[model samples]
Target: MTDSLHDIPAVVNREGGALDGPNSLVDARVPAPIAPSGFDLLIDVRAVSVNPVDVKIRASANGNGTDRILGWDASGVVLAAGGDTHLFRPGDEVYYAGSLDRSGSYASQQLVDERIVGRKPRTLSHAEAAALPLTGITAWESLFDKLQLTGGSNGALLVIGAAGGVGSILIQLVKALTDVTVIATASRAESRAWVEQLGADIVLDHTNPDLARQILEVAPGGVDYAFTSQSRGRMALFTQVVRPFGQIVAIDDGRDLDFSALKDKSISWHWELMFTRPRYGWNLEAQHELLNSIADMVDAGRIRSTLTRVLSPLDATRLREAHAIIETGRAIGKVVVAAER
Candidate 1:
């Protein structure tokens, strides 16, 4: 099986193409990625996922860039390994959120660091696995590392933007590992139901002005901790709902939040970036270890994959359609494009 990794890279965008950003459509061609050292894993990408970063970078590109591939999530087979690679050789079916600083998994063959990749969960198809990596990392880090929610904190958790990519996965992880009551905010009927089904104990509408009131209506008292996967527009409201000294972790960098509001409550704020470990080249193996743990959870049925829609044959047209849907801010789960069939 390891010998099968020798296959030549098939997907190429020789002219350095572009896609519509974050909620837009982009169609362009670029060059195939090159395998580098220390972290040499060439994935024969079978399926890929669109994240918020993909949308943002595409929207910002002015056609003057050269090496700007912006996909982060993928499920694929390893085509080649660097000389020092040991975690996985070749021909392994894997899923990963590749590095932020490098070209990403949008192409058919992607070069990735071995530390960041994990064997695809046994139960899911390529498309399903593609959706897990980025959101999974963000949710895992937000709940456990940043918020310190795992150390037997027998309390309630409020999750903002409960229907988005990271929130969807966060709800499930909290349900699986901890006894915390999961409270999530969703504005739409479908989104409300989606979070509840995903494992949120209670759902609130974020668009409503009476968020604090509504939360108190459900929990009666303030929440023990909060996780905000949505935008930063509601920092004030979040401060209101969190108990004194309660922890608040947000994955998105919110806008000009005055920490003064939180001072009264002694609330702690944490920022979670999934790319931190890989982006700065620190504790890289921890990524491999963390993802492998997720694999076990997924296989045990403790956590489920979050893939919602899957398109066929990675191309500019289908990629554009997926990007367009994501930009609308209505996509409930992750969308993926398969490079083959």
Candidate 2:
């Protein structure tokens, strides 16, 4: 660490419990990261996007009297690169949904592995690029990796909670890369419009008690695949609307889900968590490639950023506000916090 790297500004959760409004996030300074080694890149964080995982972790954190930084989706410039780092060098602009085991992007600087980082899209500002990584990766993994969708495959896909971050990008990827027809569900009129704008062929009101019936009416034989952001208590809906032997990919923790319901239809259920790659060190480089593909699609105008709101100055108060917006569960797309100019 250089002399100028002694202190770095950050927003952290001092006490790990339920959110107490603004007090839940506190402004602080942490020591500069140790010199980058191996595949690490020391980054000057330019912007960060808030995700539901950040809200969940903040609400259930246990810092043990230590400050815990909570952020994952970030876009930044590389300040320094480790000896083994080949994909990026100092001054390279990059974006990534960083690993959960490390201190996160809620700071002036962060240390991330290069294997999970991608060149930031040239057409987007730092804030816009920041919004893509986490949700984009989740959506990509759910479609291509879990649901096994391909460009040649032609079928209907049901997207539950289609107005939020993951669904916003998921809908776009499906339109851009596959022949699948999208039947997205949203309760609010604005959400329906948002999904349609993202390329949903049909939009259904998820709040409707007869949602499964409505889905079946649209895609009569049942959807070929289902992607649900909120899967708790919705297994029965998936069973009712998904075709026999179809697959369902979910991001939520639906521990109470009854797998037996799907037995009759032989419906396969898959859980997609973007963190799984870095968390267990499984095929880590795949995220790097995935983000690069997303960036290419974005630059090619095949996909667009999901950033819907931005808060300025990257302070504790702004982070708290972002958290509050996510907690409401009504965020139309992604909310970002940018560094002060």
Candidate 3:
């Protein structure tokens, strides 16, 4: 039997095109269907969402001598399953944030581990479902697994970068599942209004030099929880508004930290990397379970997909435009590419 991965059309960040700019993400074809091995599922991907990881990978692309697909979040139907796969069978509609080590989801067909995938939300289109996986997983883990927070936390929570994909979903998740007062930072008026509509109790300006003072004024005692990307150069201010014994979680890359500032208040620092489970083979099933729970939330109207923009045809040009929109640092929510039928 022919495998689904073979003979499928895909968008590739061309190898050795590191200098070619965003145009390097061209349409291409895989030479052969990659047979699924243990625990893998062969999927005919229907939709995919872009993130900063895709941009970073494309920018650093050195010729691997083959086209490198670069997308992580996708929704698709299983065309085949590995012999060891038990979570899903052929024809299952599923969604996931694919592992960082694997070829990504920007293809007509993809091979992903069954453990890391979940049944797609019945209430959502593939595009809508695709927008949730990466951001949903990150927000879920940041709140429950990393911050160990629940609906009863009732204290104030601060979210920096609250207009981006992760932040959009994070605010909704916190509002839906917790009683915490959300203070989100959005520098622009439109972004601030968007966050307000998303249920943030207060929206602060991120660019204000005395932003910490502002947050302190709003929360008074300090925020009990915060989630931010890139903690560098602003840890002192963050520490100022975070109460003693409060928690701060981050998802950015390596940066030097001055633990001494947070040390005085006994603040807990958490790092959320949604890829950690599958990257190191730890608790892969948790991702599957997490997405399932999110789907339930979506179906019940307790939450909504954060897909603010949807591009069509899924061509390289569309992808380039999507990447540009995201890079502008002004997008209020996720940008997804819906594959044409």
TM-scores for every candidate against the unseen true structure: 0.90, 0.97, 0.94
Q: Rate the local accuracy (lDDT) of all candidates.
A: 0.80, 0.92, 0.87
Q: Write the per-residue lDDT of candidate 1 for residues 1-341, one digit (tens) a residue.
A: 01234433332232322443232333444455566577688788889898887776666634654435568899999888988889897889999998878777776678899988888999889988999899998888888888877747678999888899998898999998899999888989988988988988988888888889999877777998888866466777877788888888887756888777889889998888889998898888877877888989999999888888888878767777787788788889789888765
Separate clash counts for every candidate: 12, 0, 3
lDDT of 3 at 171: 94
TM-score for candidate 3: 0.94
The regions of model 2 sitting more than 4 angstroms off are: 1-5, 21-23
Ranking by TM-score: 2, 3, 1
Tens-digit lDDT track for model 3 on 175-269? 99989899999989889988998899998898899898899999899999989975778798777999999999998774678877899899999
lDDT of 2 by residue, 207-303 (tens): 8999988999988999999999888888889889999999999999878788999999999999999999999999999999999999999999999
Please list the residue runs of candidate 1 whose C-alpha ends up more than 4 Å from where it truly belongs after superposition: 1-31, 62-64
Q: Please give the range of 10 consecutive residues that has the lowest summed lDDT in model 1.
A: 8-17
